[model samples]
Target: MKFNQYIFLLFSLFFLMSNSYAEINIKKCKANQGDYIIFDEYDSQIAEKIIDYKLHNQPEKRENSIIKIFANENSDDRNYWLASIQTDNKAEDYLFYQVDQNKFTEVDQQQFQILLPKIVECNQIKEVPIYSENFDAD
Candidate 1:
């Protein structure tokens, strides 16, 4: 009986360690950008960069806005870009994301509260068009 328990404990530890390592590797891959490595909680490394981006752009045009880029929770797809638009005062300005080759969707405050009861917030997200332009080839 003791031998069986030891085997089970070892197996569990091995599984847990391997699983965590895989997750860390994936996060590292996603966070890699040129010479800099973005760790799981390395916002400070890029915080100045985002702030600098806002500073360089014209305030009248950009409205002191910055887009905080984040990796998608669902990583099975590689063609999507997920981010959030932030204002200087507000924490949640809007969810700005791109899907495949289509439009850039924005989930603003008006649409965020329409989730169904007891449903998860992120899973309940639906894409909504933020901009569209029509052109004539003729």
Candidate 2:
């Protein structure tokens, strides 16, 4: 009887905690480059431009959001950066991009596919290079 009571209490507590939790807010999008983009709101258009990003929606997503874009002598592109946008939850699952400086011309496109699909409570997302010495790589 005592075991049953404890089990019931545990489940009740779990339900309450889950209900009290809120949807994750994208505080920042960390990318591979030396820079990162921050998004308080969901902007599908902006997210398409950035190359690599880390979504702070959850721990799994946060860790998965870390995308790596490598540039080398053989690489054609010299400059690469990460960008993110705040979009409405009801908006399209995929983010479409257009040229803002060129009067909304279609320049490029990126799909908001999560490389990391787990959710972690993150206050902010800052760019931290995987191979950077600052992160104790040495």
Candidate 3:
């Protein structure tokens, strides 16, 4: 009975620790109006453009909201960056993106948590307008 109790306690502690580690704290930030561009790890011109292009064309679909950007480059020699966006809405829809592909891919929250540390470490999370004078120089 004592041995069983010890095992149960050990399992409980492991479960708690694992759960704590799995939970990643993503800072909530305002999404600035305009474009959110994440440059590719290899090429500056190649970027993932996050914007509501329909703001002028499809006003009905436009939602007034901000997006928080999280990004990081892969460790391998191949140039790749893992990026994620969280909207400033109550629902907080989180979307993951592969900058090289310029497309959003389905990813589990667990995966998000794993890459988050690296994302915050190497990338600067900032809000930039969709249309910027800086873009004109490119």
Candidate 4:
């Protein structure tokens, strides 16, 4: 009976470790005091550096934002990427990044204007109207 219990405990630990990949990492920004807005919900080791959803989390929660890699955008000769921070309709300022051996590092805007034409389309995400009314019928 004791041997069976030990085996079950070992299996549970192994299972927990295996499924913990890509857990979200949220750190309080000293600038913001303490807010759960900024977070990284991807495993740098496995998350695709190309074309991933990113939440704005500033004013309007989960504002439209996306990350793009150079290769993913069909630029074979260049190694570059940029993020579209939904400041407004068109992304004016970009949050560029560089991936080095599964480690993501933010870099300056490089080759963005040159690669601008390569983009197929940039869809605008409209904010859905929220109505505050009672849903319970007594």
Q: Using lDDT as the measure, which candidate wins?
A: 3
The residue-by-residue lDDT of candidate 2 on 1-138, one tens digit each, is 999999999999999977663332232322233233332222332333332222334444333332332111111221222223223242222222222321211112232233112111121232332121112322
**TM-scores, each model vs. reference:** 0.28, 0.21, 0.35, 0.26
Between candidates 2 and 4, name the one with more favorable lDDT. Answer: 4
- lDDT string for model 3 (1-138, tens) is 999999999999999877664333333232333343433443333222433321233333233433334443222221323333333343334444455446554445667556555444533342222122222212
Query: Which lDDT values do the candidates have, in the order given?
Result: 0.37, 0.29, 0.40, 0.33
Tell me the deviation in Å of residue 9 in model 3: 28
Model 4 stretches with alpha carbons more than 4 Å out = 1-56, 59-61, 64-79, 89-91, 101-111, 115-138
Error of 1 at 135 (Å): 38
Residue-wise lDDT of candidate 1 within 1-138, one digit each (tens)? 999999999999998966552111112112222442223333333333333343454554345554444432233322233344555565654432233333344444543333111112222123321111121211
User: Higher-lDDT candidate among 1 and 2?
Assistant: 1
Off by over 4 Å in 1: 1-66, 72-77, 109-138
Strongest candidate by TM-score: 3
Per-candidate clash tally? 0, 15, 5, 0
Superposed by TM-score, candidate 1 places the C-alpha of residue 24 at a distance from the truth, in angstroms, of: 28
**TM-score, cand. 3:** 0.35
Q: Order of candidates by lDDT, top first?
A: 3, 1, 4, 2
Over 4 Å off in model 3, which ranges? 1-48, 51-63, 72-89, 123-138
